[model samples]
Target: MDFNFLSPVSDLVLAHNALLSSQALGSKLRIHSKNQGIPDLDAVGIAIIGVLENRNDVNYIGEEFNLNEIRKSFYGLFPGSWSSVVADLGDIEKGERVEDTYFALKSIVSALLKLNIIPVIIGGTQDLTYATYRAYDDVIPMVNIVNVDCKFDMGDSSKPMKNNSFVGKIILDEPYNLFNYATIGYQTYFNSQEEIDLMDQLYFESYRLGEVSNDISLVEPAVRDANIVSIDLNSVKGSEVSLNQKFSPNGLDGKEICAIARYAGISNKVTSLGIYEYKPSKDDEMTAMLVSQMLWYFIEGVNLRVRDDDFADENSYQKFITLVDSQELIFYKSNKTGRWWIEIPFLADVNNKLKRHTLLSCTHQDYIDACSNIIPERWYKAFRKNSV
Candidate 1:
């Protein structure tokens, strides 16, 4: 993948280029590499993730092209800090370039985890949450999951790209703690009775940006033990971000939005992050430019926290390897019967990908400490005899 032009190639021509190419693409700017190093950030840990590309009528989440500008514009913010993460996945394109963005993202996440780099995942739609969160789910326990969006995304019909609704579907589809739910920046209209009731029953917390002006209190608890943070740009008024589904004049102002993001970035456990609905068709230079800046601030906060002495060696929440020795075996369950079966009992553990995503929570308390360094452990209220 060339730093200048995207690969897997696009039929679109050079004449179509604007934002990043105009200023930074030429000879005047050069990406700082290992030898020279970046002026501000060393990029000890990072990866870039862009899952969305502007689509035509056939696609589910169709939005105009200008949105890609964020990637280009964001590079300009590159040197604003030291040890700030390098945006590694910028080469990933939207739409036709890749099939099943979720799968591709997992591969990228897997590679990064091996490197111990923090991944900053960009949009393909709010649906990116399912895959991004899924990548780290197997690594950490007591995860604090938070959704920063206006809509609860309760749509679960299962068709691809219903855009926002499936967000609820995936969370429900997977088994994360419902008690971990916390939402911010939702206006009154976006809340429904059932959604509220569920949140209440689970002790889920939310703050309506409409009524509260600067309730910074809304952001804290959601990140306490979080190993990942899911950011939906639509959490702010669509007026602030063109990619938003519902734009409004009543959204949280620019200052508050960054503060919240910065706050989220400070969490010790936030490993992977995603930002969605960056549809360029609805965007302008101001919107495009501002978002890139917002990203810079968020990264800055994460960098500061990561660089701190306590967290310096704790970048990734993922730990240990499974099927690690030639003596160990890897297995899977039958799709229909759901019964565990063994495979490859005598393979070397030189580099096992299976261990990267399998979290272990044994029925016994002693199991927690035994596997604590490798498989993340948790205390379960109820134990399923066969569940791993």
Candidate 2:
């Protein structure tokens, strides 16, 4: 993998430290873009996270877009006292890269859970999926995984590897609760027949843009149910913004993609999240700017969801339960699956064998495994605490 050494904003480390020092360091997040921004828009508070570092990757129109400059502009969002995390993988042997990436990946997710900070990872490519799941496992168990992309990304590889093959490796290696996974916006030509076949065999839901209407309601239930979200920009239609090979013209519109992003955020089931394949080299000015805006809106949605208070008394729980239970789902079962195949519906269906739980019995890992369904321990505790 070739690394571009051109980081436009050089004081990122300094800014990162300032943000870290200001936080309570142990409590749940109290700040949000809707409220005061990360550190405060009253000052230069957004600059700390900086903009995304630009490098090489495939994008729409078959070109590379360099984002180094926008990254500099984004740094302006942070105040004088903020910072972002940059994990670099210099040249390492193939066997070592996966484990090494896992280490950095795990640490970042751990920090998110610990510090209440949102992390945006720029890629070495899609194998980051391995790192994302490993870290998520640390905090939650039996959760849903959602991929909003144009390809199954289930490429063939001989061993545990990176690039496109990681998705295939995950499918091959794990005995999944097929219902726990979902894919969207896949274009016809971008995938091979065999890849297409395997993807269909799974129990998870899929929404091909060519086959369905523009309304996301066809697939909104699964997205709402996800515990972790892995969004590949290739899922977007063939526009100047999509920076990945095998892209297609008739994919998802940006507005639709952002709608799903907002939905994922508001559900707050996303414990570990990533949006990959944004080739800075191919993206023009508008594309780069939209990336930041799209991501910010997603966070804002989640912040709104988490901040909005609800109780068993107010009927929000009842409304949520009814809404969730009403969604149409196609179930798939792969033999020799596990003892239990679960879906967490909160108050939606308490009598479900796979639904109800010993209250507060779940660890962070358990909640993540259940995805959008399980209440985060913090949410439960805080709701109870505030109610008291």
Candidate 3:
């Protein structure tokens, strides 16, 4: 339970919290403060941590940033009927080297995960996601990550790690713990053709901005199957965020991004959520308010979570069998939540990563497609990955 790497939330934020309404979220938090030190984490379901390191940002110029405004905005909002306890553990200041910061963040995230406490990280750059992924090396045998971003961020791993290319490092680095990586709201124009081809070849998933914008529910299945969810603020449209934070003229709007965050929160397997690429400006109230609302929605989603994924009891779900071409596709619908899942047959002969029969999350549309003699693309890719 050593959290020496963390610094207490600033006195200014603490003073601000004192003046907030008794029903405000800030008033109910177990805060780590200069006067009280780190708060006890007993029974805490979520911990908020900030990482102040952006040296690896591709556009870095020795600039500095802080999460104080985001915290202020979050504290001012009234809580929903949330059953989960939240604590703000404050920030991890930039270390002497970028790698040092990564090590500290990885350590804190790993400790939180072991305690079954989901860490909601507010970060300086998206590359910090690499550290968070590494934290799962010992905690989980395999991991699935869902990135809400406009670009693939799979820069060349052969070169040094940058915020844009940290995914490449995750793919190439040791432990090989990553089972699946999916990007939602990716802009094709922002990515090169090779990256797109690489995603297909590796069986990784990518959803374009247009497709997801047209139907935000498309994000549910992908996020439902994830272990970690990372969001880059740049995924949001220029009009939705501050000028300094904007990276694209076209991207997810505030409502779309918050919905995605809530989907991440609702996922039972998702243990960590990081919102990165925050840049401060004089007029950052808009962006700060947006980030705070996203956090609020995520917490609300957590409060409403239902354990409907368990299929051990046949009575809990309805089973459907359909034939697509010569292959039999098995679909299960949860009676409680109406969520759909397609089964991936386990292969006994080959070295199977899953080691047993697995159900991949899907939508009702996928079932309709199967009924129409069409195979769901996700099922096909997952099948191929399993066989390999």
Candidate 4:
């Protein structure tokens, strides 16, 4: 509830909102403005906060940026048949130091999480994800993160933190809340061999760009298991986004990225979502519109969420047992949503993060593979990590 660090949305964006149609999303949102200050969050489900700090970016050269254009594009879009209340709490200006900005972000996100309100962050750099992850230190004992990006961003932990290396800090920092980390749309060339090896040694999950693009559904399981989801705009191919937002010539397309966003929104376990690494340019309409559409898909997915994970009632889900290499694998299919989940047996003697039996979100393909004597990679990773 302590939102003193937040600033009101700019007057220019508010003026644009005044001209939007009543049916547009802008008219329905509770917006913070110079005159109205912060809006009431009594029934708000999603609160959008923009951060204007990027000093931690490795490529930072004192260039300035803003979220007004993205806000304008979002406000101009019409809403779907949805009931979730949304609020725009406006921007967080850069503090004296980058660490100050991180502290402010962590405080605000932590506060929102306590209130059961999801914070949708629009950030100046991907490193801000470190702040969001730290927000979970006291909120949740175990945290699962799903990053939709082109690289692992696991730079050397011994060196200073940068946008591309913040994940290293997350792994090495105290409290040790991270239970699982997964990367979707990773390009092999973007990651160093050491980082790749480190990811494997830690038993973290990763999906390649080709694997994801071939079947976008591969992202659902990873995202559904996450508490925090961070998206890097540069993960999209250069042709799919504007020049300023482009980084790789080969990456996810706009539709693919939007699909990933929607999957994040549909996940019940996901508490926070962030889209970062935005750079403003003279011709930024395409990028802004794409970001707005991604937000729209996410909101749509939230509205479509169903409570099908409850497995206590035998009738609610169908259970399947299969043996692969003498290892009994248990899988459950939600009758309500037809979604699949594989159970990771609890290890009572081991000092592991998961204290009880855990059900990892998986695909029907995994069940089929298990029946054919193949253990799903995710199940193997979780089982291995738990054993350690």
Clashes per model (N, Cα, C within 3 A): 7, 45, 0, 0
Q: Which tens-of-lDDT digit does each residue in 244-346 have in candidate 4?
A: 7878799999899999999988999999999999898888998999999999988888888899998889999999999999988999999999999999998
TM-scores for all predictions = 0.63, 0.59, 0.99, 0.99
C-alpha lDDT (0 to 100) for residue 288 of candidate 1: 63
Judge candidate 4 at residue 72 and give its lDDT: 99
Residue pairs in collision within model 4: none
lDDT of 1 by residue, 90-111 (tens): 4345544433456667666655
Q: Name the regions of candidate 2 deviating beyond 4 angstroms.
A: 1-67, 73-98, 114-116, 174-179, 211-213, 242-246, 306-314, 317-388
* CA lDDT of every candidate: 0.50, 0.47, 0.94, 0.93
Give the per-residue lDDT digits (tens) of candidate 2, residues 1-388. 1122113223442344245433322111222222232332222111112222121122223332333433433323422221322221111112233465456555545555444544545443556665566655546545567787777777765754645666766655654322255677777677798877775455445568764345565554456557767777767766736343326666777787777777776654555567666655543555555565565556556555542222324333211121222442111121221111122324442333234421211222333433455444323332232232
Candidate 3 lowest-lDDT run of ten: 240-249
Considering only N, C-alpha and C atoms within 3 Å, which residue pairs clash in candidate 3? none
Instruction: Give one digit per residue, the lDDT tens place, for model 3 in 322-376.
Output: 9999999999999999999999999998999999989999999999999999999
The worst-scoring run of ten residues by lDDT in candidate 4 lies at: 240-249
Flag regions of model 4 displaced more than 4 Å. Answer: none
lDDT ranking from best candidate downward:
3, 4, 1, 2
